[model samples]
Target: MDCEILENTVLLAIVTLISVVQNIFFAFKVENESKIANSKSSQKTSSPAFDKVYTANQNCTDAYPTFLALLWCAGIFCSQGPAAFAGIMYLCVRQKYFVGYLGENTQITPGYIFGKRVVLFLFLMSMAGILNYYIGVFFGSDVKMYIKAVSNTVSPFLLIP
Candidate 1:
């Protein structure tokens, strides 16, 4: 199979790993906080640690669908390499955001900012790629030719398996 055919699967696996890490981190932190609070349940706790972990987890949960949509759309319509790079960066920043939020809320700023920018970039790329495809379909422009040329130029350097 061509590597291009597997781009979405690779991206999905990366996203799933990031999500699993976040969930595990949240579970461990909340469990530890529960122990310190002398409670068996951390849910709805007033402890600062629980609050931070819950907030971080909730933020990621809220943003996850949108991120996945943009990532997949961009990867499908645009080239895989840039989409994969941005997806990895977004995942890394999410990890940073989780860790930073645990320390100081203000420390999350860098990750938050970068993550937002990456999402925006993915959105733009998706729009451009989709528009290009439709234009080719509607106007008989050789979109595949253009995409093939660009891919041929870039794919050799990407070296995806």
Candidate 2:
């Protein structure tokens, strides 16, 4: 396999590993918190930890497919460097969001803002990549070559736009 392909594969695997670890951590937390919450005298209604963990797990599960799709599209069609960067950022933001959700004042977590922005960035990256790929295909141009040509003249900040 090509070195770039191998590198991107490894990067994707690492991202998957990160997600797995986070899931495991949240699962364990939920299990432990649920038991404690159930045992408490006044906890019959709800447990903050249990609720937070459950919601975080659900959110992660919902976002997993979107993350994978965006990662692959951007990595394959646009460039590995940007895609990997965005993927890693997405993972970090997700982790932070999960952690922040466990706080007492969950409604005011900064992670919510950061995570949403990261998702938006990933979405934009995927869209740009898909557009680039189709434009290259329709015009009988090498996609990578076209991307490179544009990258050479465009500012880094403007690439996503």
Candidate 3:
């Protein structure tokens, strides 16, 4: 690979790592706040509502890891506008996340809902698009070499250090 590509990859990796760490901390805060708001003051406790809150909180664990995956994977795929694309993807997930959780009883949610299937689909496509562009940009050898570059990245990296 060209040294420029390697340099860009390193920079992308560092930014993504930092972004992921920040997201994890943010998720914890969101979970704690949700727990407090969801908590009952006068009620005697012990209910499915609490269970729902716990489950929702548990789902927040992937907040940062997902971002990290997007970052690294995006670095492998996108040529530019990574932050913008990733940000849009993140916002999309947040909207879908809340709607999915409340989807058990009905399709529509009062605020937002969470759904695994939707998240899975969105994440996959978003990452794929980013990855595709990444391969096409710095790494590709020719105008038509995008797919080849992607294949190279997906393939095993045997000791080139």
Candidate 4:
């Protein structure tokens, strides 16, 4: 193909690589946290080590989405910029909630949790709206359909945030 096309292909490859590596990181975080949470639950005192699970892990919200990002990025050769951006953006959104709301893994503070959740919801919804609008045009689909597709694609990335 042309030089511009070659450059785009390379850029897309890089983006996809980043997405997969991010997924691996998410998986490790969740797996590690699960082990720690299980072990800590059995104990009387909540140890710092136990807390480490949440604090250290990115709360592993978007693992599935990250994986999907990797897959989709691969299929499109990174041509689907909206999808890739959504995947990564969703992960970031997840981390904020995971840390702000789900941290400490205690009975969540309801007020704090609700507030954080509302914020996250608004944020993601706005992003989904944007993707739905623009990408929808390209795909010759409705906003709702595009939104659904993008949202579904990034579902795995939807961290508890």
Per-candidate total of colliding backbone pairs = 0, 0, 18, 5
Q: Rank all candidate structures by their lDDT, best first, as comma-separated numbers.
A: 1, 2, 4, 3
CA lDDT for candidate 4: 0.50
Residue 7's lDDT in candidate 2: 72
Clashing pairs in 2: none
Q: What's the TM-score of every candidate structure?
A: 0.74, 0.74, 0.41, 0.35
Estimate the lDDT of model 2: 0.68
The lDDT per prediction is 0.73, 0.68, 0.48, 0.50
Could you tell me which 10 consecutive residues in candidate 4 have the lowest summed lDDT? 71-80
* lDDT of each residue in 1-161, candidate 2, tens digit only: 79967875776667667777877887887888888888885647766667878887787778888888777776666666656666777777777777777765564366566656656655665677778777777986556666645533442442241
Q: Is candidate 2 or candidate 3 better by lDDT?
A: 2
All predictions: root-mean-square deviation over Cα? 5.5, 4.2, 10.5, 9.5
- Name the lDDT value of residue 63 in candidate 1: 92
Off by over 4 Å in 4: 1-3, 41-91, 104-161
Among all windows of ten consecutive residues in candidate 3, which has the lowest summed lDDT? 152-161
lDDT of 3 by residue, 40-78 (tens): 555545456445545554555546466556555544554
| Higher-lDDT candidate of 1 and 3 | 1
Q: Which TM-score value belongs to model 4?
A: 0.35
